[model samples]
Target: MITAAPHTTPGVLDGIVVADFSRVLAGPYATMMLADMGATVIKVESPTGDDTRAWQPPVREDMATYFLSVNRNKHAIALDLRDDDDLDTAHKLLAKADVFIENWKPGGLAKFGMDPEAVAERYPELVHASITGFGTTGGAHLPGYDLLAQAASGLMDITGEPESSGQKAGVAIFDVVTGLHATVGILGALQERQRSGKGQHIAVNLMSSALSGLVNQTSAYVAGGVVPTRMGNDHPSLAPYGPFAAADQPLILGVGNDRQFRQLTTALGASELADDERYATNPARNAHRDELRATLETYLQHRPASEWVEEFRELGIPCSEVFSIAQGVEFADEIGLAPVQLTGAEKVPTVKHPIDYSRSQVAYDKAPPTLNEDRQSILEWLDAEEG
Candidate 1:
């Protein structure tokens, strides 16, 4: 139910066109980022619409908010690729597109002659980006769901308390990570095409992105031969680095090094604790984390979390009171981030893209469209281009 803004500015990716055949979270999220940067992304869905369109209950004007979250600033069209005419229309769109993105199974699009190999051969200049739950090899048969990725990638193994069952992230983290990887791959391929005058395939799978996104945790296993386990909110290596009770509520302390530990102890009126051999160095403090926590809480118990947050911030200590989603957004706005914007005539609020550029601005011209709302105009544009 979001619509186009009346006035707009040209974006950095103004000339690029994206043929977005991606559905659901990962693929659509990537194309949305592209659209935010000013690419003309044509989202081609099935005749029914993208699957997320039906993921409702949390609805906005009867449209799925989940769908709206990643479909903004793009035109949409419904086409049944199973039908010959609709398949031909897709081909025509690809012919004029700078990038083609999809998340179908390995051979899913082969019947329609839209497989990566076929698309690459037919549109030699177009970047073909593929997202899958797993890679097209051994794991292709498996579905590419975020929870599965979290479970398979050792993420769930290291998450939550040791005593509790493994838990998936609050959000679809791997999906978002995979989308980011796809966007990077597409942009890199586009850059390479500038010199070679040809595009290449960019394959990103959720499992692969999950491993990479795990970063230090994966490194602990692969590089150090240490299989990390769940420790709840506590960091495996960094002591005094998790949430601690602060009179009224919990405050997270991210004291990473000896210097920060010293600063924290000083701020808490417990400078003597930092001087103790058992809590002086990071490794030493980690060894006695329980004792350190017990000691710190004695001093922290006098002040509320908010007061501690302010005092610790002024002292350059990395500490914060845990915030709900609404509070997080409000904090961002209060700090002059201007994180939200109203879109379309309905004035729907959407998050602004996180990045800022000196020479070019991110576009927020169009809102998430109604199903197949731009089909006629898109087809007319295609005809004009073909002519």
Candidate 2:
């Protein structure tokens, strides 16, 4: 993706306007991607503000960090859809926009006069991108939240220690996944519009995206007839392929084949164990993985995880020290991921949008707005449009 450098901008979607009706993580994440791609995003928030605005004590400039994480690079406009004037203004904005994004319940928008088909009917070429708890089809009745989706789709069932009750992933994996799928749908619909000169209704939901993301595990069940189970830090099928405790800390390693396993054993100077039938080939090793893990841990516990990482990397094994969120950001910078964008230096340590387009950018990074911050100015603009 093109960098949102002030001096040089590709502006692929420069003329396009996106009327953002979504809030919170998934919707905002999708719009942020769109804004970064150069669309003008006007965030239409409810009057009390996005619920996330006051989400926590970890505030930046006294504003919630939860709010800051996603609502960047867009103009904020608060609207009470129940009020006729505000609803009229919203309709006006939608009529002129190239895209409309929302995260309401299946029939929520229809009640508000903003359903996808209605918007498409009014603006045939508008890309109506929606993210929700579930799709409008079979799972429509279910609520859409990351944890709930995880639990509903069986992801939580395979996430924790087998002996313990399954746990949700540490992060809102399903919400973020839905956001990404939303973006994909929007972009694809936009491309189709280029060809047919008419946009289509596109949607994604946490529940659907969560199920889609369980590709490997689901494929195993459907194709191989195996009900996958929680194995804690261990791989679903590959044994001795998860986190191991070194002398100082836990480190993860991906031993792909017998050859790599041999290399790992040699690194530990325990090659003799590989020849033993109990730990010989991959399958045999997997079958007796507990025994192999015990033997490996005995040797690994003699060295620091950091030291093990260095040597394991050199052995062409995929391994790394598990990092906390902060450490992950630091490591990303060290390896050129540059995941953090230091706009205004340390004052705004924002996460960069993942996609980088050579010929275009999403939106420029802008701070989140205060409640009703854009109300006066937005009303003025709408008044001017009417005149």
What lDDT tens digits, residue by residue, belong to model 1 across residues 112-174?
888988888899999999999989989999999999999999999889989988878999999
**Runs in model 1 lying further than 4 Å from the true structure:** 1-7
Error of 2 at 335 (Å): 2.3
Clashing residue pairs, backbone N/CA/C < 3 A, model 1: 133-144
Taking the candidates one at a time, how many backbone clashes does each contain? 1, 12
- Per-residue error at 107 for model 1, in Å? 0.5
lDDT for residue 184 in candidate 1, whole number 0-100: 94
Please list the C-alpha lDDT of all candidates, in the order they appear.
Answer: 0.90, 0.81
Error at 259, model 1, angstroms: 1.1
Worst 10 residues of 2 by lDDT: 1-10
Q: How does residue 212 of candidate 1 score in lDDT? A: 99
Could you estimate the TM-score for every candidate?
Answer: 0.97, 0.91
Instruction: Tell me the alpha-carbon RMSD of every candidate.
Output: 2.0, 3.0
